[model samples]
Target: MKNKLAAGLLGIFLGDFGAHKFYLGKPKTGLLYLAFCWTAIPAILGFIEGVSYLLSSEENFQAKHGRKY
Candidate 1:
């Protein structure tokens, strides 16, 4: 299962490289983030998403991301 805390931390730290997206099993999205990282938009979005993930409950996260791939 994907860990919300881990995802959140990654987003806040390595999100510029799309680390959080990769961790969430979204390779395509991760690559997109990488592509636009130079623009700094990904970093901002990642931070927001990270906070959203941290604030979300397990059930909500699971419901949105699924239980198992």
Candidate 2:
């Protein structure tokens, strides 16, 4: 299972390149974030998402972003 704390940190620090999304197994979304990173939107979105991930329950994070078995 993916860890929320790790994902949150990655999102906060490296999410300009969609690091957290990749960690969460959402490559398509990750790629999109990376593709548009030049606009600064990804950075802002990443910080928000990082905070959201940190605030979310483990069950909610897993249900939304965990890898499929």
Best by TM-score: 1
Against the true structure, candidate 2 reaches a TM-score of 0.89
Model 1: lowest-lDDT 10 consecutive positions: 60-69
Which ten residues in a row are the worst by lDDT in model 2? 60-69
lDDT per model, in order?
A: 0.90, 0.92
Q: What's the residue-level lDDT of 45 in candidate 2?
A: 90
* Candidate 2 Cα misplacement greater than 4 A, ranges: none
Candidate 2 residue-wise lDDT, 1-69, digit = tens: 899999999999988899999988889999999999898899999999999999999999889878767
Model 1 stretches astray by more than 4 angstroms: none
Pairs of residues at least 3 apart in sequence or in different chains that clash in candidate 2? none
